[model samples]
Target: MINIVYRLKSPKFFEESIDEVELDGVIVRPTHLSICQADQRYYQGSRPANILDEKLPMALIHEAIGEVVFDSEGNFKSGDMVVMIPNTPFGEDVYSPNYSYSSKFRGSGFDGFTSDLVNLPEDRVVKIPDDFNLNVSAFIELISVAYQGISKFTQMAITPKDNLGVWGDGNLGFITALLLKELFPKSKVLVFGKHQENLNLFSFADEIYRIHDVDDDVVVDHAFECVGSSASQSAIDQIIDIINPQGTINLFGVSEYPVPINTRMVLEKGLTIQGNSRSDRVDFVGVVETLKQNPQLFEHLEKLITNICEINSLGDLKDAFDKDYISKFGKTILKWNI
Candidate 1:
């Protein structure tokens, strides 16, 4: 399997060129293939300094649900559908104390899931239930993220009656809203996005609007930031304006640069703030179990995936990533025919 590799800040389809060498005590297969956001970014020249130093070029596809075609150990068998989790941990680097879910992340300094036939560590993959659809099952990572946000606020001193608002109606926001509604059945969950078209995508929002509609006098109990941009900082200002005293604001979205936050308002309101990553193992398993027992509960998510890209080769992969036409819809996928 000729797979994409990142080296020296460049991404290329390297064919069986480096398989003869050993990497960090692990032998790699030359026939590997996979595709995901990580791969696209690397392919498009987005290289972090740390990754460049480590020579961290590997298969990239973190959000993947596929069948295991090879099993060196008895722990997995061919044809078993599984979700691949990245082995990269937050603690691997000296600067990871503040990161969330330090345990397992699929992509970023780790080999990803997009590959035609890539070798996987035995412990890095988890078997999906027989009834789960691999395409939909691939969304587990995203669902786990939403689960984490919901879990954090619920752990705080608030109940189902607390007022809740999510800023941004993107995939994360919608998922968080749905999760919040489940966790806090009675809380008012509103979604604010830049556009009304996005609001239509969220079936869980109690109310949706543009930023201009923000009522300066209204008090919100729970607020979430989902857009990972400096604009998210403005969300902090809005949170301070709308939240009641002692309310909580969850900063889920992150920006590349440090966005200015209103520290004084936070101090004055006595707001509880938190940053949540992926869900805990218990919560992850529980979400799977709940979906298994009540499959219909997540029927809405099926529609959320509005785009699917069947990746056959690097050309196909590049087209999907570069051409706006392919990504205009919601979630996109690269189906590997093994």
Candidate 2:
């Protein structure tokens, strides 16, 4: 199969006749690839490592939902819908000494899901429930990050508390709020964003307020910053301003550079800061359980997916990155069905 390959040192290359899996022991055959912020950085040369190098082209997609066409280990059978959880095993790579989040990301430094087929390993694939929506399930990896962040929030209290304040109104922000709503039905949630157009996209929150318009009386027990930029610092500051004393703040966004934060207030409020990364297979399983137990939580997921395109060759692939087209899509997936 011909696959879209990201060569770190050179331009993006599509290679044909290569084996389905890399020699490093990672199984993958690219299927659908989303141009995430990480992909964008790689394309622009902002990120290090030569993608053209054999190691870098290993593939690029981390957030993917697919079907298990084959599994030699008998862990899964053909026709099972699954979500790929990319994580490098211990000792697999010299850098995986601690098995941190960076060790297992496919698209981060290896081959990704932007190809016609991704031959993922059994352990990397999480079987989705028969009734789970594929499109919504694509957000499972992301939901894991949200889940981890919120899970931290639940841990801070001797008793589980639910009130949450979500900062930023991007897809991550919206999805995090959705998971919070489903996971903690009794919790009162508030959403803060600068753009009404973006804020209006989500309906999960009990109340949505502009950053400057946030009410002073509402004290949240948990807060999150979903936007991955320096701008998020302001959002964090806002979150700290309104959260109750000892509230936990979850920073789930991917920031390419460092941003200034107000440590004094964080200390004064006895705040707990938490950061999360792509989830594990266990996280996917938990999310599937949530979806199975509460089917109604998916009611608005379809609204979150804005576009899907089929890519046959390199030409169509370029169109996939055309900022004009992708900007309008909340989740733009390059489908390799053709």
Candidate 3:
């Protein structure tokens, strides 16, 4: 089959190319795609020159839900709704495959779902209910990332999880804190962020405090640092100071440069800093099941959709990225009509 792929030829530039996509596996026609921070970095050329040179001219979306157009194995019927998994893991390893060197990621290592049709293995696509909200479901890949991180954190942290603190007012922080509250109803979910306006959106949180405004008496059992980039350094410093000794510090942020940490504090406090990245198929499946059981999450997840743009042309796709860059918070969803 002929597939039309929309790739980022360079920073602030996109072009379409025609390619042959074989139906060796499940073929999905993407319905809704969500733009991620990583995608914006590629679109804006914020990555290192060397990395950009190697990764450029690739499709720029991994978070998306689509309809199964054809399944070679008949696992899914035509028109079935499903979420595409971008992390392609190969080889058998005791540790998670996402950490393996053999893994190939969409939008980063290869072409993403910005094409007219995506041919993926049957196992790579998880079926979703027809009644599910396609817009909110678009970012299930991101939700799975959070789910996997939290799952890992819970498994490793040996201390009390009474007070869980999430740093960052952004989408990841919001999602992490919200998930923490739902998963740990007995624990207090505290959100610390720089923007008051962003923090205000976490009405579901037990406590919301501007990072600087946090009282000295306040402390958390563990902290999830969702703040990446320039502010990550400060967020980590604060987490080290406010987090109780022997607590785990979960790091979810991606920083191009090294964020120096206070090794003395980490050693003295005996902190366990865990880094989380892209998730695997299990994580994706867990997210789908969780969303199915708790439909109320859709209402909260819907708030993250600040801008919804339809993409019927390359110009429309470029415009969506520009609009997303200017937005202060929330996610920009691309309705993939193209």
Can you tell me which runs of candidate 2 are displaced by over 4 Å? 1-17, 20-33, 48-58, 92-102, 158-162, 323-329
Better model by lDDT: candidate 2 vs candidate 3: 3
Write model 3 residue lDDT over 1-338, tens digit each, in one string.
99999999999999989999997899999999999999999999989999999998899999999999999999899999999999987777777778888888999999999999999998899999988999999999999989999999989999999999999999999999989988899999999999998888898999999988989899999999999997899999999999999999999998988999999999999999999999988998998888888899999999999999999999999999999999999998989898
How much lDDT does each candidate structure score?
A: 0.62, 0.67, 0.93
RMSD in Å for model 1:
4.6
* Model 3 residue pairs with clashes: none
lDDT of 1 by residue, 1-338 (tens): 34434222345443222332222211222222224344555666556656654544554556666666656556666677766554444455543322545554545655555444446565445666888755667677677677766666667845334678888776777777777776677778888888677788776667776887866555667788887668888777787788777777888885657888788988997878887755434455656775786676567677666656565655666555564234543566556542
lDDT of 1 at 207: 74
Candidate 2 lDDT, tens digit per residue, 97-132? Answer: 113533646766455665545766556777678787
Candidates 1 and 2, the one with greater TM-score: 2
- Write the number of the candidate with greater lDDT, choosing between 1 and 3: 3
> On a 0 to 1 TM-score scale, where does candidate 1 land against the true structure?
0.80
Find the 10 residues in a row with the least total lDDT in model 3.
89-98
Better of 1 and 3 by TM-score: 3
Model 3, residue 310: what's the lDDT?
93
